[model samples]
Target chain A: MKSKIVSKEIHLKKRPAGFVTEDDFELVEVEIPEPKREGEFSVRNIWMSVDPWMRIYMVKGSRIMPPVELNKALSGGCIGQVIESKSDNFKVGECVKANFGWREYWAAHDADSSAKNITKVDPKIAPLEYFLGLLGITGITAYVGLFKIGELREGQDTVFVSSAAGGVGSVACQIAKIKGCHVVGSCGSDEKVRWLLDELKVDYAFNYRKLGESNISSELKRACPDGIDLYFDNVGGKHLEAAIDNMNIFGRIVLCGTTSQYNDNNNTSTTSGNVNDPSTPTLSSGPSNLSLAVSHRLRLQGFIWSDHNDILNEFNASMSKWINEGRIKWKESIFEGLENAPKAFVSLFKGESLGRMLVKLGPYTATSL
Target chain B: MKSKIVSKEIHLKKRPAGFVTEDDFELVEVEIPEPKREGEFSVRNIWMSVDPWMRIYMVKGSRIMPPVELNKALSGGCIGQVIESKSDNFKVGECVKANFGWREYWAAHDADSSAKNITKVDPKIAPLEYFLGLLGITGITAYVGLFKIGELREGQDTVFVSSAAGGVGSVACQIAKIKGCHVVGSCGSDEKVRWLLDELKVDYAFNYRKLGESNISSELKRACPDGIDLYFDNVGGKHLEAAIDNMNIFGRIVLCGTTSQYNDNNNTSTTSGNVNDPSTPTLSSGPSNLSLAVSHRLRLQGFIWSDHNDILNEFNASMSKWINEGRIKWKESIFEGLENAPKAFVSLFKGESLGRMLVKLGPYTATSL
Candidate 1:
């Protein structure tokens, strides 16, 4: 590895008003510092992840996580190989997953503070990119959301997943089917709908954009005639209202993401506005029929992936078994280079990504795997 | 007991278009028939209970329970004595609780069909009216909602109860306090607020009517500075929005009742309208800030008392202990005669009752105790 590697990174240029744009981020070149402290190592990034949740962190005062500081490098899930090591814990050429994404290279001490954020990856388990998608937090989120949060009963629950062609939704749909459930999914495009039906083997898939927002409930009714037993919500707003309408008695709603509301700039600005200002516009109104939660005995729960770390071992075992049996499959929409990461992220809200949206920064050099 | 008694009962005259009125009910007089069949008995009603949930049954297509038939006698919780019995199970002069309210007298065979609906009541337990208020379904609802649904943690949680001066709400406030939780309650009147703070021993109580709907969220923040951990929601709409605003991470919201939306006639009529009609007014828009459920990892669950029959024994044992320890207290706003039952039921929405509302019909004649 070069003693001083010139790495390009994306930094937050400005906060988005409503919908994020390419200009909100700037690609800048910087010097990758050396591992000077004891138990420190440097890594060359192989693959980086771009998710809808990143948009949430872009805004200040977001309750989920801290906002991305102005002019600072944006961070996310990344798979990288250790090139320089000064610690006994991490060895050279070992691939690891860390939160030092949106950059080509990163150096960090393997101390208690940063050690928890980094994990060694087995390249032989699948592929290097799979660590940033299927075998990573993305897959763990789908598994935990369905089994732990949604409590999807095998062969019994009629599961409906929104954003079914996306990373988490695609995996959740396949997992539900593998558990013998009747799966229904809704996506933005006919191409994505076909992918959901043919590739993912979902029992039913619909192009929500073609159906129009007003007909979401009716579309859901058509898809799940028996009523949805469990709903994995990735797109909130009309999708949430529709799910509430089609929910069976005692149905569960796992609140994963509100991709629809993410770009609704009105919700974001109003949330940061004067809460005491009576004139402040109502931040995106929730499902109108939420009271149905009572009449129908429904349970809607939201969860962060980090909160369920205890279930990682259990998730890994089941996920590995499914992968070995060829029961689980995933798709990635990769954008080459670090500069294209911003464009890839902006395309997410446009419903352009077929599955996991990732950016390729470098290549895997672990030939032994 | 008279062979044939002239009994007065309230019948559903016309379902109200909006909030219920006195004209919606009609007082009708009829001759009570003799208990001639085997295992049959007749009784003079002593007390009848009026509840907000009765309004839900008045609608044509309520999902919770069967709608009340027009021109038929309205049924609810009542305490009566067996004046005549030809059965081995029930004895004459024995007091029993049954769903034969809204009438001065009732006669039914103690067959399997009706036997399941009636239960022997010990007048020695407390006052006969207590059977309709503190020791009846009202108290049980509060217990189940707090412990089973809200998962009220003793001495740990910060609890908030909406409509905290009403039957279920008042009981819930006390139970939370008894469990050593920091409790806050919201009622419609200053008088009720005083009752919540002084008698129920809640940490804080606010008059929501005085605070106004716009200030509900601020009021909640003021009352629960540390944020609400568990919310016992009786009044939905603004209170729900406020609860969502002040909820801490991983908070639990028990959807006990939507007394606010129940009276919003638009919700009821639109719910019954054409499923395909886009112009059909949205049945009461839920809390506008419900997406906070995702960022905050909140859980909102709705429940019906009938579904939890298995927890009855545990509830009874705990409730009895609380009553014996003098930790449980209740208040009732009583209306005289069956004709006044309509007024009592209507007053619930008006917040005229400080606690449980009941209609007194006859007197307790079981003097053996």
Candidate 2:
């Protein structure tokens, strides 16, 4: 049966070539269906997250995860309220977070999927939008990359983070600082750099764009005079090289996202080529100084936050405590409607967003109290 | 007092720019002095080890270790018989292994140096030369890299080892096979491939030189249909790229040596360059597919065997047991005389050696019996 509620969703019009343009996405309108079957529930999304990883989903046949199908509503992190429920698992008016983003409304059966993907989030602990930012996957990504993968040495490690003003990076910077590490952050703009230094209180913050990619290694060496013990890599091209250059012995490099390479056309070429073929230069080169990993006894590890779902409860507890104690702070750059979601996602690569980039679909009515 | 005996020694003539040659070294003759001071001992060198890591020592201003001082006698792992002793710690005619290679005779105070560097070795524990090869650092290197660093899962892991007929790689192959792992080995020649398949009895053996660098990934995929669970990387560059492309989820890569890059002139440039400089292509490129580490959740770790000397006794126990059980085997390409040491060293990069390469100065005199 039709609920008489209209939903606007963003769909992939075409796969991106290099950098994503607004034309790559198409906004489609549809009617929201009422939940009729048992264990089925409908959500009216209040906030949707725009992340860099979504670009991977836009590519055809990604080895990491299945690409988003053509003309289908794109999926990501979203915070919504249960508007219709036929399931005992979800109650109407309860705030929840799910991977049904880029849409105004979503309908799903609780019994059809694992509970790990969708879960109830309390508005009393944090603002509803925070479930899409600091208290959500963004915060968990930082925690897992630092503690689990990077093996951050509290009060001892000198940590360097690239794309420090972005969602995961900003949280990573603050978390490293809170853990008493000497934190250095690199960002695209002076404003972001200022926010990293003044608000996040990072030990050092530099505008990489101003310095240019050519001087990244020297600038990183200058900022982290003692050398980086742990590098939280977000921008992976020149930034990764710079991190490799300035890394100390037994350093740990956490590969989170290659934001710098995401938009590069060269990165999409999956075919192997002859080593002597000069025309196929992109196929042969990565970080030039990777040989240094041997002499320095370094470790480079890559991980997806969702792979560590068993630690969600532990992460939530720590994050909640940090939020309550004023040890953690977050910033948001919000777009007004679902139609602006594509613009928000594109803004991430452009360095236009301050921290967690989000799209607001509707107002959230507090259900915690 | 000077003895009547004259000793010949090999000294570094100059630091090598690209590949090492005989001209980089010089032979010198000197008188062998008697041990005059208390706690002093004299040793007559018999066997000297020529290793790939020696290339790193020849480069000027290496960050990994102190470069060999210009015009000085080259020092390395050597098995020797004590000719004379004034120290209570050592007795004359006892066989000892020390880092006093490249010389016919060496004298030092036992009190001035740590005992870790010099210790009496039993000839009964295999052969005296075995202390410089399999039962020595070579065996320990493979043991530490597989069990300690690579964390090999016995009977479960599909292991890939590059330079499989070389010193450490041969030992690594046998150890993995003994542990019940399905092993794949890549070497330079058909003869070495035959040895790997026949004697080493690896699950798969391929001549990488015949396969060509460009085809390494496809060939590796064909050999390891299930994907590589652990890659003991000795030859870097294309071999590393191949391993990355064929790596399984949560795969581990133990970075032992970069044999392919040791002679590379591009590797010595420590200066940071502009990311856009076309002339500086060597400074910017490594393994183009390193980003796969993110999607596959792979980890690449670099290590040196000496750093783990704390487990020497444990390593000796295991290796001795393996040798007695006929589970371990080794091959040696020996060059006679101290003057041929330079030739033996250069032969390592040419892939001329079948297994552990050595320089034989004299024969062992069965001191253990």
Candidate 3:
């Protein structure tokens, strides 16, 4: 068989100020590098993830992760199949996962090459694509932030999740439900709300956008009549304020993410007219009623999932069982090819994806087949 | 023996709009109620406490406790001597602590009563007045917030306390120092700062008012170059913001009180000319940099010591030993008579008190004396 010699890569054209656009990214073709060293392998990418955290990586010096440099291949989580190998650890047609995404082809040596990261995947447990969403870091994040960091108790606590239809939030919504909590989810669209309420069987689901000019505080109060006990906050700003106001005594606010305040003005929706004014992005300055936290004896903790890798085995065991038993459900908004990878990433901040937004890079190749 | 029939009380004239004042209180005389039923006793008030928490009670519908009703005598923690007893549990001249403050006389039977609450005080352990300040709830609050809620470790963690010379704050600062932490403190006045730095032996102390026009954020950065690990927050607003910004990874903020935000405008010092505009009280709306909490993995928890009565015995044993050994130091800002109680209460908001503020109503009366 003839070896594929070319790879098309997506590059970060410029550092984005607020919302990313098509001009911020570029698609370029180059000859794939040969793995000259011993214990080297070459892989053709299949499934890639476009997560909200990638947006954090784009902002220079804002987070712990090194910023994605300009005019370079943007790296992220991806699933691929070995096309060629010089290492005993990898074989041709073997499926694997790596942090070498936003590209059509990758050439590397060993499991961890500075150029391309690789980890062998077990397809017998679940579909190859499921590893990118449900069985991936996204699901792990949901499990850790909800149960571990949030201190969610089954059958007792009430949970409210913002961006409930998004990747981490959707999984968080179902996990709280499975744990026997009174689950309330806030989504941006009516369709998302319906999916969360009907499909996910969340106890309460509201389209925060449909609430109109009225502030989210009153709507949140009406939505959660019993008051929020554990708030898994993905979207900050008004959602945070509303959560703080409606929290019960000794309520715990798990600061997982702040998707709403990604822009300077705190505007998440791209269709909204306010995007042009980058100078005066009308973001909620902060939670105005933080003083209430004192009287109510609330705890607001912010954490990242990578710091909690010890729970991975437990998460995998429970999540796999839940998936097989049909106790858990997941949805994906898929994009085709490396060309649309930037689009998928941008769509996250715009609330365009109903579930986990991903890009299909190439078809899975199996040695068994 | 002649019975004193008349009792003087300070009544809540009205819920003040923002900051409390002399106009919001009135001195009135009423007949001291006689213990008519068995298990009832009458207490001649000796010492009453004017805490920052009492300010929270004055605010209409702000806390779990019923707001001090307009035109009614405001109640709080107080120490008194038994003048008459119909109960075998108490005897004449026995000193007791109860929630019957702002009045010169109190009569009740049970530990918790609608009119008065009485708990027998062991005066032999320390002075009778010590129960109102150091050996009582104020000291317990500092201990619980510093060690329990804040999870302070002795030499490992760097501690920072706001209102560092106030009742709870001063005790918290000393407790942290005894625990062997490098301590930093923030106070409202130069005298308070000197007291914290020189007398208390805190590693760093700053008069927040002296930082003038400059934000607390920069001053806090300079004060805590190593970064704050445990924060006992009494003053909120800018102090909270500064603490949040200067915190190290996994930092814990014990939200004991928010004396700075007692006024809607967050103006704590009455002597500072910044209080002119009732319209704009110059409060940092909320911590604008709460996102930093997420990056640093911060835990901000608000709590009261009453919820942690389980530790009172331990607190008393440790504190009494510390006091007897002279390892612990304390200061008292005393105002004599029931009439000066309201003025003392207002002085708390004004940051006029260097340490625990108490109003002495009458001389201690122990039969053993």
Candidate 4:
């Protein structure tokens, strides 16, 4: 049979306000184009990763991470089956993880195929979608950020993670636990607090909602009395200030993402005005109390996981070992169709769902050996 | 023959004003108390070191260094002698360096003498007072703070030293000069500016007075076209803000002292009707642009020379060699009598004098060298 083709894409509809609405995203269908280039390949996207960082990417440019242009299909990591291939490097019908996004069927360009090595996906050790979450960008981000940026030492240290129940924080907490450090995490709700404490095995967890900005510090002090030695920051506003006060001498603050600050389509904003009065001094959330770096001799730094991709195989082996030993565990808040991927990405910023948010595509429905 | 003992001291009498008065100081005489215990020896202060840091130390609750107590003799580092001792560890007339300050004589207590070490003073290379300035705590502070904390590499970098004529900055410029990096120094007067550019061999030197607060940053930029890599801060506050603006990526700001902000002793209360001036917030002269540390990836740090004292011998040798080779030279604004030291200390906060301000003690008559 001639290779079947279809166009599936997640598109932004309207800009969001405070919280993202369903109108913000539109799922579209069109004709799929065939690849004419020698290195090009076509794959039906089976699994699409929905992440908090996707929220930042969705917004055009209000932050360090630039936002996606309006109307562009939001790109993320995807596991897909090769339906057709012009490149001999990828065989037909083999499952592989590609750096293509919220799409049903797509032709990856030569650069995308090279940069994101088209590797076969395995379902035996865990679900194939685990390649997008526990073994994907989130996993590598957690590993490198903890070890390299945070200088996470084993035993007799304190670890504080913001967005503790989220994908990256969950992995960081588990790693800190494995390294024998006291890990305290801050999440959005009581349910996440419960997951962090019971399931994820974080030393301590707190619902950030219950504590007001003024009191968040005292409550954090109660949770991690040992003091924070390594702070893996995903949310970077008042949480950063409290973390600084709680930090021990020579602490390392790793800048992963500021998910708490990004709002839907327009992400990059240098200044924010007070609600009551515009003349009142504006609020900018990302950088807070930098003088803390001087007093306590703290090292605050920002980095991307892609910068340290050299440690990929080691990260995979270690994470797999922990999963088999039951030392690490994670959950996916998965959406049924590829069309819902944009909604899942929006929900990440709105605090609507828990865990590694994702969308499932077709071609992985068959029962595996 | 018995060693003659003349215990001389300079005591704090009254609190200071914009300038320290005779009433602010009291000269006293006391018998040199014999050190009682083993490992304890008497140190007759030979060459007492008075520094810009000493002025900040004279005030209460400075964020940089500890405050000097009222009614007590001021204490800092000095080249001294073990004239008489009961301890087996000590011999008579051994030259040593101690963190023993402005007093003419100090009987070593076990605790105060802990940082004290036996090292012969070398006069031929520089001067006997060089132990109190260039090859002393000040030099070590500049070396470690510039090289280690600041991470100042050789080329493709610029340095801006505030209070460039002060002890630390005076030496730092030469060091940066030696490293083949561009160095700009900020000092008080036209004379000091000439001295800095001519004698210190800094690439650029500007009188901060001529380029006052309003024109601070622009003036600094004119001096350092490449912006700043390493900022050895001695005169903190508004100058600090200018330095921040000129800081390049991954820049390091070492907070050696904030001489400008140490004038709390001189902030005379005005009977301006309402203390709560909601109309205008009272912004101090210190670095108001502290937030710049984030986007610029600047490291603002304060460290005591005592932390890296191990490098003292190494710095001493190099500094001595440099002085002998006529490769480095700096002015010492010596206050003639012990009484003038208080005036000199107060002048630091007022920005009146230039260069390393020192109180010439009776024992430190340089002619003996």
Using TM-score, give the best candidate's number: 1
Residue by residue across B1-369, what tens digits does model 1's lDDT show? 545778888899998767789999999998888888888778889999876657767875365456789999999999998877787888888898989899999888877535457988887767888878778777887888888888889999999987777778888889999889999988767887787877888999988668887798998888889999999887666778889989999999998744433433334531321111111122356776766787688999988776788888888778777887899878767889887899887776654345667888988785552
Over B1-369, each residue of candidate 2 has an lDDT whose tens digit, in order, gives 545568899898988767678898999998877788898888899999876556666774356557788888888889998878898887787888999899998887888657548988887778889898788877887888898889999999999998777778889999999999999988777887888899989989988667877898999999999999999887666778889989999999997743423323343342111110101112224777777787788899888777888879998988888998898878877899998999987776664446667899987665543
Best to worst by TM-score, what's the order? 1, 2, 3, 4
Off by over 4 Å in 2: A1-6, A13-26, A29-33, A113-116, A258-284, B1-5, B16-23, B36-38, B113-116, B258-284, B346-351
lDDT of 3 by residue, B104-213 (tens): 98777764443444678888888888898788877888999987899988788989987777667778888898889989987767776777878889999887777852
Chain A only: list TM-scores of all candidates.
0.88, 0.88, 0.87, 0.85
Model 3 lDDT on a 0 to 1 scale:
0.75
Docking class of 4: incorrect
Which prediction has more favorable DockQ, 3 or 4?
A: 3
Q: Which stretches of candidate 3 lie over 4 Å from their true place?
A: A1-6, A17-19, A28-39, A86-93, A107-118, A258-283, A346-351, B1-6, B13-26, B33-38, B52-56, B111-117, B258-284, B349-351
Q: Is candidate 1 or candidate 4 better by DockQ?
A: 1
Candidate 4, DockQ score (0 to 1): 0.21
Cα lDDT for residue A195, candidate 1: 81
Writing each residue's lDDT as its tens digit, candidate 4 over A293-354 gives 44556666655576677877789899888888888788777887876676666555544566
lDDT by residue (B166-264, candidate 4, tens digit) is 667778888988988899987767877888888888888877667766677998778777778888766555666788778876687776522323343
Q: State TM-scores per candidate.
A: 0.91, 0.90, 0.89, 0.80
Candidate 3, residues A60-109, lDDT tens digits: the string is: 53544467898889888899988877887887888888888999888887
